[model samples]
Target: MDEQLMLVENLDMCFSTGKGNITALHNLSFDVKKGEFLAIVGPSGCGKSTLINILAGILRPTGGKVVLDGEEVREISPKMGMVFQKYAAFPWMTVRQNISYGPRIARKPKSEIEKITNHYSSMVGLEAYEHLYPKELSGGMSKRVDIARAYANQPEVLLMDEPFGALDDITKKQMQTELLNIWGQENKTVIFITHDLEEAIFLADRILVLRRPKEDQNSLNFIQPVPFSRPREPELRTCGEFVRLKAELSEVMLK
Candidate 1:
């Protein structure tokens, strides 16, 4: 097997409330290999988003550690990029500007920024709309812009928290195809979080099923490998193997 690119060791998260402390994640541990796509699926309160936040260094875990490339991660690292559930585009910025934001902040030369912005915009099929503001784009288009913006930075590890959850079924499927293509070309390690079991199976090389934080100290219920061949086709969703895995995952979630 490939050496682990990222490791989560006995991670825990707690938040204080008026009533008392609330545990959002409990002793969760996992490893992600370089260039692999991993999906996290669970019930609504199962700490999926909380786990992403911890990995991104947006929230410090109460216990345990995150190690990336053999070093413990204490804060946000340039090697990571995040795409939130919500459309994170700036309304005031044009698509080009939004995609170029990261490179600009990193003090990249204007020529380099323009080159990356153009490449990613075209990759996400947003070249024609590069000059358009966020308000003018549809939900699907806005999501594409968000993806383009993330890729523009060329982070080695990409974290997506229910990125396509808000799109319509048709649009979501299209975006999934687009995402897979981008993932293939970029070759970055990806950790995707979603509540949809089918979507998880369709996109991940491995699926991590999380349990509600209150249910157990070991929040990770299981880690199942996806057996489908790469460059998966839409037809694979109806195949027997895919159906069986989905059924198994559904049962696990409901239990």
Candidate 2:
């Protein structure tokens, strides 16, 4: 079995609104193993993005702790990288410059930045478009650049918050395949957030279902393992087992 990479214990988040305090997450807990792909699914207002933000150290939990490789996470760490739903490419920067941004910010040598940029640009199939700016790219191409930029940072864990939610179905499927291909090569631990049940089943090693907190319930409803063998092909989405799992998760989500 793979070693545990992260542990979230009794996590909670609350916001101060004029309507008074709103609790976004309530006593959420889970663990992610090294190199595992874990997908989080929940309805709107169930705190999925809030959980991702807390995990990224972008937001501090009101209670509980996030332990990464044994140490408690109090602030952002280079071991984690995020890809947002919005394709957050810098409009002024070319593809090469965007992908190399992290390394450059860390003051890596020019030679090393060039090597890292070239490697990841090719990894996401964006090598030929290295000179292109964000406006020149299509939706799918822009997302590829986002993935490349995140991975170029060489994070131990990658957090994606509905990164393909903006794409059409066909493009979303294509990007899923592209992402899996890159993930296979790198084997970095991934925590993916999505509302699409099929998308969750298709990509994750395990699926975490978070329920909207009620008077008597905790935020984490349950965790389900994906039984499908990986190197998952696009056609796997149509398989009987995949369909069954999707249906099961859909039911869970609707509850």
**Model 1: residue 74 alpha-carbon error in angstroms:** 2.6
Tell me the spans in candidate 1 whose CA falls farther than 4 Å from its real position.
214-217
**For residues 1-255, could you state the per-residue lDDT of candidate 2 as single tens digits?**
379999999998889999989889999999999999999999889999889889989899999999998989888888889899998999999988899989999999999999999999989888899999999999999999989999999998999999999999999999999889888899899999999999999899999999997657889999999998879999999989889888877888887
RMSD values for the candidates in order, in angstroms, are: 1.5, 1.2
TM-score each candidate.
Answer: 0.95, 0.97
Specify the highest-lDDT model's number: 2
lDDT of 1 by residue, 151-216 (tens): 898887899999999999999999999999999988888999999899999999999999987644
At residue 193, give the lDDT of candidate 1: 91
Q: Provide backbone clash counts, one per model.
A: 0, 0
Worst 10 residues of 1 by lDDT: 212-221
lDDT of each: 0.91, 0.91
Per-residue lDDT of 51 in model 1: 89
